[model samples]
Target: MPASELSVRPLTVADMTRFIEVDNIAFIEGPYSPDLVAWQRRFLEVERSIGLFDDEEQVGGATIFTMRLSVPDGRLVPLAGVSWVSVLPTHRRRGGLTKLMRHQLHDLHDRQAEPLAGLTASHPGIYGRFGYGRPTQSVTLTVPREHNTLRLPQGVDDVTLRLVSPKAGLEACRETYARRLTSRPGMIDRPDFWFDFETDDLDQLRGGQSKLRLVLAEREGVTVGYAMYRTNELGPAKGEVRVNDVYAVDPAAYAALWRMLLNIDLTIATVVPGLAVDDPLLAMLEASRYGEPALRDGLYVRLVDVDRALAARTYATPIDVVFEVTDEFCPWNAGRWRLVGDEKGATCTRTDSTADISIDVRELASIYLGGVTLRSLAAANQVTEHTIGSVRAASTAFASDVQPWLSTGF
Candidate 1:
């Protein structure tokens, strides 16, 4: 069908039921509750909700969340995140998906949202054409029941883990997560994001079950860490436990929380973490007896606006470098940006001079959170450094020792 034959318009409040229906048909096994649809519509706004309709029938829908990310230098940058992308099976191969995506991208560009756009792709191969690249990795780990013990270092004391109601624990979890997410690149939090981030998605692999428990780790009467998990029977003599989400303010608390989860009695011989990448839990263990860890790509980020995205996160070290970013999907971000940073922080601004390093926007997105390094990109020829010292300096300053982990699935 020609793009002109289908109407792509802003989703209105009246389309809620049809929207949910289309989403349900598209996702099939996923959760698209009325309450969730209502909350998402309100939180994201109708203007951000674009739908493809064939003669008033809603065939597909996509939602975008707008927010700012605080950089290491305390600079807040604008970012656009894509979520809830769905299309009816009958609408497949039609121009509905393309129209919706094109319209949304145009809208974002018009808004001058230069920081970039991010999303978790249902089909990894589909979004690359839109200049989206996998910037972060997620890991799933299964540890044998025996290797679950954790040895803590000194000065980490009084760690207490307790169960809390999901509703009651939402605020504490959100607060702690906000603090942790801002410093990490490629992580963006919406203003009314509390609902999705705090609430469980009952349909996802790790979500949707009522038996899942929320464990809050407290120290000195303050909640510092939390985990969402559930236990199930794996076999006749074995049981399995899975962690949906887990986070802590400090290393000790994080380790203690894991230990508590592992030590759960009557359960199978092992525990699994739903989403983890380069998990510290592995290092904290005494040996490699832990179950095998599997790595998978998580979020794909596209910088709609380069300057705003680069300025949003704080850096560990101070350095100056120029990046020639090629954004094929979003033309606005395709250019050279001079990023200068010091102990005080960093700034990303357009420059006409020669670039010290040249890379595609996808490569930058991959390293935006300091997870991937410039050297790796250079090795892959994803990045080309003009100056010898500049590459090392920029990579050292921008790279993060700790890999970023997204506990919530969009």
Candidate 2:
């Protein structure tokens, strides 16, 4: 088919089966079922979505979801999240993916969205071209069989930790997560996030459809911590337990959650977390050897609109700086804007702004989740400094103490 023959448009209900087929071919996995495709289509129809087709054959697709991002002072800012991007293999290098992304970003801009987009990248290298960058790093730690020395804290006695059905435990999990997500940066939740906490298919388990057990740590009949985990045998006497996610409001509860999962009867070793960059789980263990941490990329964020994205996040310190942002794909974000921050909050506005810093849209995304610093990017030449003092102050203010972590992948 000729390039001009291809067309891009909003996905419809009738395209469900073809969408699933295209996605499976694109991802090289069979996780997307017809029902899942239908659900996704419905979700897209209700939200902002786009698709590209080559003569009736689905080639690419992307969806955007809304989230209320909580700033430092307990203010919730509306955010537009992008996810589930895919392009058919045969359509690679044909600009199908780029076209779909551009359409989605333009749609987001028209909706008065602040141009914040988040997704878990299938291929880390692919998104930078579209002005997306890694905002957070995920650490996967593996505990050796001989180093399993996790113990429950003293005075944490009388607390009971038991496995419960995902269905029975949905409300508790939601309650525990709600508290965590609000206080933390780079975390977002939607109303339907807890709709179905359990599913029968293994492939759909990531979205709550797995045989994994939910362990709730209860003290005085109140749940404080919870972990979703599953154990499988790698070989005889060699078992692996993977923790999907574990959260606790207090130290004792945190320790108790780890103890219960580490001591799961048949498992000799455990991979207990998908931790944030600053997770203390490694230091909490008896020895660092007990938890060998491995780093991997997590969430990929893009600033659809620089001003909106800058104003949406709460700064850690009071500072002022101007950024000359360049975006080739989304031209609306390509300009200079003055960003002001103080103990009160932060705001971005257009001005005859004299820039203290300059960077591409990609670098801005890298710093959006508070993981990467402007100074570091500046040092690497990804960001250029005009006024050193102002640049340093602004960068420091945007930095977050708690490293970003996405509890769930798109």
Candidate 3:
């Protein structure tokens, strides 16, 4: 099939039904239920959605949600949360996805609504070409129930835990999440509809596990943390617990909730997903038990408005350097810019000074959160240094006191 025959455009209200149909076909999900369709419309906007049409029939589509993304130093910025990206099987290899991505990036840049665009990638091979870099890596843990005892904190002993229904505990979970997002880089503030989506569950969606359960951690009757999970019966006397999400405001609260989930009765092992690279649970655990830690890409980010995105976060040290950035997809970012800053503030401006270093915008985004360093990127040939010691100086300035972590999936 020729790419020229397919046309991509923003969706209209009347085009939504077909848009959803093509999305389902592309993703291989069955026709969405009427109730689910209504729920989607409540949060998703038709104008913000785009579809690839083949002779007036929708064949591919994607949408973005307005999100508040936290950066280092507890600052928040608008982020375009890209989601539901798919193209029909017949449209594969026809440049359908490539066209959609090109259009989406241009739209984001033109609107100037967000300084960054981000998504959770279903396939790792895609997105890098568009200058999106994976900045955070997550770990999956399956700890046996026997060794799951958390090394208790003195304050945690005062914290209490209890199981509550999802509906009953929604506010507590949302409140804890609201605070956690500010403290952690790469976390996104959940909107009202997102809260509803996370809490609502159907049996089929549970993978034969028990209904979703909510466990809350509190101190002096004030909620500080919560964990959402489910248990599955694998045998007559043994089973496994799968943790869907967890958040906490205090160290003790976090430890307490993990302790409760780890000790859930009748479960031989507990599966925990999206643990930060430096998550405290790693130190509290007695042993690896039956599970091995595996790294998973957490979030892919693109600096749509590079100038604003660079200035939004605080730097670790004071340094100045001219950066020649190559952005093939977003050419507006392709130029030499001087960035100067420290912990107090930073600024990125167009410059004609002799270039100290050169890198792709993707490399810059990967190191933006301070997770990846210029030295490491240079070692991999992903970054080029034109001046002696510039890599070390730039890396030192960009280093983060706390590693970036993204717990939210989308």
Candidate 4:
């Protein structure tokens, strides 16, 4: 196919059913139901949806959730949440994905809508060429019920654990979620639709597991944390508790929630799809007896506007460093820049000074959230340090105690 063969345009509401159909086709998943499409309508608005057409036939499409994300300093900034991205298998390697990605980035940059764009990648290598970087990671864990004893805190039992209907406890859960948003680097300032957050009980999503169950952790008659999970009881010795989402403000509440989750009768193990790399649960659990922790990809971030993205978040240490950033997909960012800041605040601006470090924009994105370090990238030969000891200073400024963790997919 020629480069000029296909055109990009905003898809109409009429294309939604086929839009979903194409996603299912590209992913090679089982057939989708009308209920699936209907439920997705809460977030995937037609206005935000765009598609690639090969002479009037829609071959691929994607959508964006205009939202905000919390950074290292407990501050929230504009975030373009990209999701539902897919291209037909027949259109593979024909420059289709590049076109889609470029169109979206250009639109954001042109309009100055969002400084950062983030996504949960289906495949690890697909998005990096477009200036995206893996900034956060998760771990898959299966903890057996037998040896899942938690090191309890002094006040854990004081926190009351209440099992409420998911719908009944949603307000309390959402409030608990909101309190922890600014504490973590990658937590989203969730949209209204997402308050339901993984509580949907549709049959297509359950995979034969029981409907979502809600547990609220309360201290002093106030909500401190929440955990939503489902149970899979297929046969003898086959029961499992699947923790779809969980959050807390402190050790006691977290331990209380886990103690309840781990002891759910008849479940062989507790399966968690995404656990933060440094989650406290790991330290509290006697899990080595039955589970082997496995690493998994979490969030990928792209800095659409390098200067704006850099200055938006505060630094940990006082430092001055110049970065020679190469962003081929977004050429406006491909130049030398100066970043200066202290523990209080920071600023990044275009500069003509000699570069202290030379790096690709994608690598810069990885360090943007402070989840991955520049010195580590330098060791891997991904970041170039031209000035002696500059990487050490810059990496120290970029350090964060929160440690980035994306609690949910877009």
Best by lDDT: 4
Clashes of 3: 0
Error of 1 at 281 (Å): 1.4
> Candidate 1 at residue 288, lDDT?
42
Clashes of each: 21, 4, 0, 0
Task: Please provide, for model 4 over 1-410, each residue's C-alpha lDDT reduced to its tens digit, 9 standing for 90 to 100.
Answer: 44547667998888887888888898888877787877777668788789988888889988999888888888898999998898898887777888899999999999988999999998898899999998898888889877898888789988998889988988887888898889888888888878774666777877788888998998898898999989998688679999977888888999999888888887888897887788888888865446678889888999999999998888988889999999999999999999998878888999999999999999999998888999999999999999999999999888788678887787
Using TM-score as the yardstick, the better of models 1 and 4 is: 4
What lDDT would each prediction earn against the true structure?
A: 0.72, 0.73, 0.84, 0.87
CA error at residue 315 for candidate 3, angstroms: 0.7
* Candidate 4 clash pair list: none
Clashing pairs in 2: 115-304, 115-305, 199-209, 205-209
Best-to-worst ranking by lDDT = 4, 3, 2, 1
Q: What is the lDDT of candidate 4?
A: 0.87
Clashes of 4: 0
Taking all chains together, each candidate's TM-score versus the true structure is 0.85, 0.91, 0.96, 0.96
The reply for model 3, stretches above 4 Å from the true place, is 1-4
TM-score of 1: 0.85
lDDT of 1 at 291: 68
lDDT per residue as tens, model 1, 69-158:
443343456656688788888778877777877787778768665556778888788887776767677766677777766667544567
Error of 4 at 266 (Å): 0.8
